[model samples]
Target: MDEQGVRGSGSPPTGRFRRGAAWWRSGPPWVSRWGAEGGRDGGAAWPWPSTLLLTVFVLVGSSFAAHGQEGERAALDPFARVLLLVAAGLLLWRRRHPVAVLFGTSAAAATYLGAGYPYGPVFLTVAVACFSAVVAGHRRAAWAAVGALWAAHVLVAHWLYRWLPPTGDAAVSWGQEAVVLAWVVAIMAVAELARARREQWARDRAERAQAARRRADEERLRIARELHDVLAHSISVINVQAGVGLALLDSDPEQARTALTTIKAASKEALGEVRQVLDNLRAPGEAPRAPAPGLDRLPELVTQAAGAGLTVEVEGEPPRLPPGTDLAAFRIVQEALTNVVRHSGSRHARVRLDKAAGTAGDPRGAALRLCVDDDGPATGADAGGSGNGLAGMRERAAALGGTIEAGPRPDGGFRVLAVLPLDGATAKEGER
Candidate 1:
């Protein structure tokens, strides 16, 4: 049968060959893609250059083995030469069908030896096939190939010792058998080790990819929070003042001028804050260092809101906090106040800050409480908001081990209350 048709026509479709074929193909999907050309890890193409080199090695070795043998015992006819060519050709399919190719080449080489041809590294084809199967994660097929070769060795020795003259290393001694076994075992060992290393590399690459995705998610959330804080409060104030200026332009020129000035100041502050947010996008080492806004800025925040026509009352002292907690607290208050200005209709709003030492004698625990409340008959401006403000505040507070409660108060206003843990937050930030 021709080489291309041999697999289907010359062999039984059941038993060891069938089992081996199934096992070899059942490996990780990537094994099939491992060709000698064009793929990710290694190409799955026929490694022609290497196969040609190995063919030359075996043929040259065969010639050398024949050189010293006496008589017509070592002479090769056209048929014997074709057998060697067939054996080498089968090796070209090694990467794609390692188990099948190994068996085919080994059978051809065994035929050559059994026919009294001079021995060389004719078994080199079998060794190559065995190694390829193992590296492709086909342990069963590789070991099966080795076992079949050993069986072939025994048959070849029994057949040749009786009729043919002993050529180079052809004696059927136990030492020769031992040496053959040792060589096959060594090649299998090396192939198994290579398979292990490749699998480990794949796993490590997957872990690194997952880690990068997680970091990207965290960075996206941080940027969203910054944009919300920078734009929400400032834009709300500016919107209100702009409306006031337009309303008073002719009737009350002096109040209109003051309203326009407030609009200008709010816009300037918004611009500066947005610039800081943009600067933070720079490479870590190049980013400017600035103290993050915290509760200490509440007084300024109140003044800004008052100018926007909201009457804000501030009470109690805000406790010292870790940077993360401080930022969370500031944003919670800012969002609450912004919502009041934009959504709540009442002019009067109240903000309160207080510290709570956790359950009596709880040496390791304390928290800061923040509350913002305003009477509501929310205007149509609230409808234009995307409704992400309160959700963003909740996410920020949760990140620092805090909780936020926000809903309409029974007395006819909306209220936001956040409690942020302080005990371990600062220590954790310091460690980081």
Candidate 2:
């Protein structure tokens, strides 16, 4: 019965050492289920020495009890002795079969008492089996076994001693029995509480893991959006230049050469930025790359736009800006120039950057202003009404605690104006 219970409880089929090897070779069932196979090497093997010590103590204690009482020893029948031994043997598999051990040992102890044998070893066996049941996650079984043993003790003692007159001294024995029962129930209650705590901890750990996964998915989506918005415009420019080069290769050699060069430069820059983003995705442990296209790169950006046949002029010097502010400034300029080439149908464009003392006590300490004016016809034609380019530029500036205004100027041209805070040190530090 104990063997059957051990099998039913899903314990390892092999010896403790072999089970430890299996647990190490392929991680425990819980870890494997979560796809964390092959964790640490091996946990501590089962403590065989403790089992050996318990066995030795039980055998020696029973032998000593049998030797000390002559009449009790003689009255013990062979069947009773065998039952006691079976009860003791059941202890070997107690951890894997607590319910079966409790039942079998309780029944065997009852039989031993019925056969008129000494009750010392039988009582000891019941105590050990009850404790084992409580420790092995079988609180309900432990309570039931305690009740059955208490009932059997009362019935057997009453039946054996009923012929004698009652001395009215039942209070002490009843008190001892009550104390023992209370102790066993209290121990089982403590174990149950501990099990509940462990379950709560497991639930908390699972919730934290789920939240982390959700956060990672959100971050990935955000990164994808940024990549699309930043790189798509450059890719579109490259595509247009490549198409022009292909069409003019046979009819206009010099124009085709210029277009090819522009395409090559645009493609190279796009590949570099894309590679940086990909690297960040693949190896998150590495430090991040430099900030993407800050204000410092504005000169090269303007030169590239000019090479693409749009005349660009820069005026005025601005105060140093925060990293995010600089990035926003660069992107606004890039998008504005791209719009000029793609939609404005303008031959000349001017970019102005200026810094001035704060007015109206805005709390930014200093104000940085940017203006882009294009000498193009104000008529809504050639992707003029799309508004995507202007919206993107405005979003970039607004993200840096700035505002933008874009519309047709009264002088028959288009204009974009933005005002951003220069003293954003507190905001930048807070982000870090």
Highest TM-score among the candidates is held by which one? 1
TM-score of each: 0.76, 0.55
| Clash count, candidate 1 | 8
| Candidate 1 residue-wise lDDT, 1-432, digit = tens | 111111112232212112233433333234344422433333364466777788888777777777765454557667777888888878877776787887788788778877777767777877788778888888997787678768877876755456654354345787888898898889888888888998899899999999888878977888887788778889889888888989999999999999989888988988887777778787555745667888889888899999988989988987777777888898889888887787777898999988988786765478888988887655544334755787788888777777888876667677789888888887656543
- The residue ranges of model 1 lying beyond 4 angstroms of the native Cα positions read 1-101, 112-125, 158-179, 358-364, 377-381, 426-432
Worst 10 residues of 1 by lDDT: 1-10
Clashes by residue pair, model 2: none
Clashing pairs in 1: 34-44, 35-43, 35-44, 35-45, 36-43, 36-44, 36-45, 37-43
Give the count of colliding residue pairs in each prediction. Answer: 8, 0
In candidate 1, position 324 carries an lDDT of 79
* Model 2 steric clash total: 0
lDDT for residue 166 in candidate 1, whole number 0-100? 37
Off by over 4 Å in 2: 1-172, 222-230, 281-283, 289-292, 298-432
